[model samples]
Target: MKRLTIAPDERRHIERLVDDVLAEHGHWDPVQFVTQAKTVAESLPLRVRQFFRQIQSEESDVAVLSGLPLSPDLDATPTGWDMAQKTGAGRREEVVLALCSAALGEPFAWGNQQDGRIVHDVCPTPGMERSETSGSSTAPLSLHTEDAFHQCRCDYVALFCLRNPERVGTTVVRADRLDLPAPLSGILAEKRFRHRPDQSHVGPHGHSADVADLDAIMFGPPGSCYLRIDFDDTFAADEDDHAARDAIKELYRHMCDAVERVVLEPGDAIFLDNYRVVHGRDPFEPRYDGKDRWLKRVNLIRDIRRVFLSTGVRSRVIS
Candidate 1:
């Protein structure tokens, strides 16, 4: 468990940087905002920058940064996911999120998600409380690797929390924490796992969507096996792969027993190595009365060029 705290001076530096960027850009443009974030990343504390440079994905699955400055009256959490106002950053916390993510790599959005919005709002909605999207608070979200069905899925998922009054728990299951049985490990390392795209990533008007054709749940080098699983989105490609099915059951039991709950406080952000961790949240009542928990989430890619669908200096959703 690695942690980094923004020093008082560093926090002040951030405030000045954000203010300057907003005054220059005059709007929250993803392209320009990300570039500014990268500059802010360079001015961050040395320890934070060093850790991001050298952290082994499998060894340090998640890193938390704390002691950032928050806007006045934290009670003013956004009510919904709409940014129809089109005004620049509502607060500096989002800039912190993007800056921290830029410290690692390029941040990108999903074309089929949130209408290609790079920064996504994570707040419980009235009708979506039981749904499978991030807005759900009543239904426990099953552990999952972000966008497991996509070939160009994010390498890291960064979440910045601005509000969380209920102290609800966020479930995290890391591959580094799992010591699977040989049989289960062997089965999971094969390429027989089935994955369906998360409902949030599917578009209504588009080419035909199909299940991803994948062979393994934990694929990569032998030592650093990359995890790819979403119990809700994953199924057996061959129902008769009893060995694989049995392995899945056993693995689930092990992971459930070893799950960890992370509760983020004000101005706290966590960056998860998506290839090494599966995360979810426990079921909680969302009052939805403007005080519900809210987090700004973004997906990071180590190498955007490898996954980009078009040529452009600006970032975009993978096609």
Candidate 2:
């Protein structure tokens, strides 16, 4: 009933469109995927189309579309990135996510993450069961803007669910929703914060980008503040780092009071405006018996020129 939901007819139509695309391509190809998905999204039912466009100006940090068809015989949750791309085709849920991503901008992947594969599997990995990365299941992931430490991080991030046996929820916190206290707000506005890149970019298969300090947490057009931060990776350079630790503590306090958790079903996909909000996942038991929760993730930048300008490389990855 809410804007975050999808109607039965809309879902069916989306599936039909996805079928049309797969009939020719038969696989998930990023370049062709966006062109076709855009057309399908534009032709979606008025309600759904309206919701899709809301990513451009919506006050809510996250927009979700549900009820698209999901196959019961979906492949076993992928253990890693290679398996994810190898098995990502023909899923209307992926098409739905691609469509939403195209509406905002071009979908891109980080070379440092998931082996630079276009599609990423967010499943509980065997050894990473307790880490903070997407593969972890036992620990509650802290809030973060995906790739917040990067200068060319995406403008939007979307997660499409293929399985969720545990129904574990993702937590969201909106920067616009909070009325920050004067001191904390002032500190956050200062160019005193330092955020390290997430683990996805720190490992051996990680990016070559330098880990540097962030100038400010909130900055954008007037009346529209975009936030970039990570609870696990960002830290103060020193105790005199503009009360950085205290500033983080204050944000955590606010988040504790105003967090919203959404449990995505099999047919649901949520597109988050990365610049407007931060997201994390709740702790869940990993049933590595091939039925654990799983999701597909992709990042989108509103402008392609930003990517080129940031790294001087015209490729999708900044690292």
Candidate 3:
């Protein structure tokens, strides 16, 4: 896997973007900041465009980028539009929003987490179950795509740490580092694996048991490849797709041994090319005694048309 380190000059550029955003609207209302950031990003320069393109290409395989200034008021979770108005780090949202907007050429929203229900499909546990008791144990999460069931996958998924776990909740990312054998490659190329959405979320309404083409190669771009995987062992496909599914399972099993794990500390933010890498977390005992592990997450869809905004699908703000 190729490593892309953030050069001092590039880091300075990121800092400048953050500073500019905060300086202009740090004191504004959260709603107003969101609106202004959108306006500013729409007219970003060509150099910024090139910078993001470079980031996408170079960091396709490397999953972690360290060394960014931590906001002094970083909290356990991000304050929503309403809550942000009353917090010291309210401006931090604007700063992060601006940085991601410049980096991905698309606007982003704060992931809403209300009463332990996070909006995005984050695994509270490996089993996808919320803690039955206030004192339940946390398991090590396996590497998988953020949302494999969605038709329009986010171009990038980022997690910014507000607090680290007491024990071990190290993030593990696997890329092309795990080599797939010929048999597995042939099975995947044949496109035989099928995946169904976990029944938990789909059961409330009339969601169907839609199965994904698991054998399909996760990445599509020319220069580099990304991955989208479902780590739950219970996710099974049809009999005909069994061989291909087995091949994928075998590859993933190998990945368990080949992962380059990193334990993220406070203020660390990890951005993953959602299309290229599979990420997971090591299990840790969450001491629910007020200091449980907490990280703020954001998902972004890169504008394929940053260089040509009128060509692709128009960006929409998810409410």
- TM-score for all models, in order of appearance: 0.92, 0.90, 0.68
List per-prediction Cα lDDT, in the order shown.
Answer: 0.77, 0.76, 0.50
Return whichever of 2 and 3 wins on lDDT.
2
Misplaced by over 4 Å in model 2 are 35-40, 86-92
Clashing pairs in 3: 140-283, 226-275, 226-276, 227-276
Order the candidates by TM-score, highest first — what do you get?
1, 2, 3
What is the full ranking by lDDT, best candidate first? 1, 2, 3
Candidate 2 clashing pairs, residues 3+ apart or interchain: none
Candidate 1 ranges with C-alpha deviation above 4 Å: 56-59, 83-89, 205-210, 309-315
lDDT of 2 by residue, 58-82 (tens): 5556777777567657777777556
lDDT of 1: 0.77
- How large an RMSD does model 2 have? 2.4
lDDT of 3 by residue, 126-148 (tens): 23223321112364565666555
Report the lDDT of model 1 for residue 87. 34
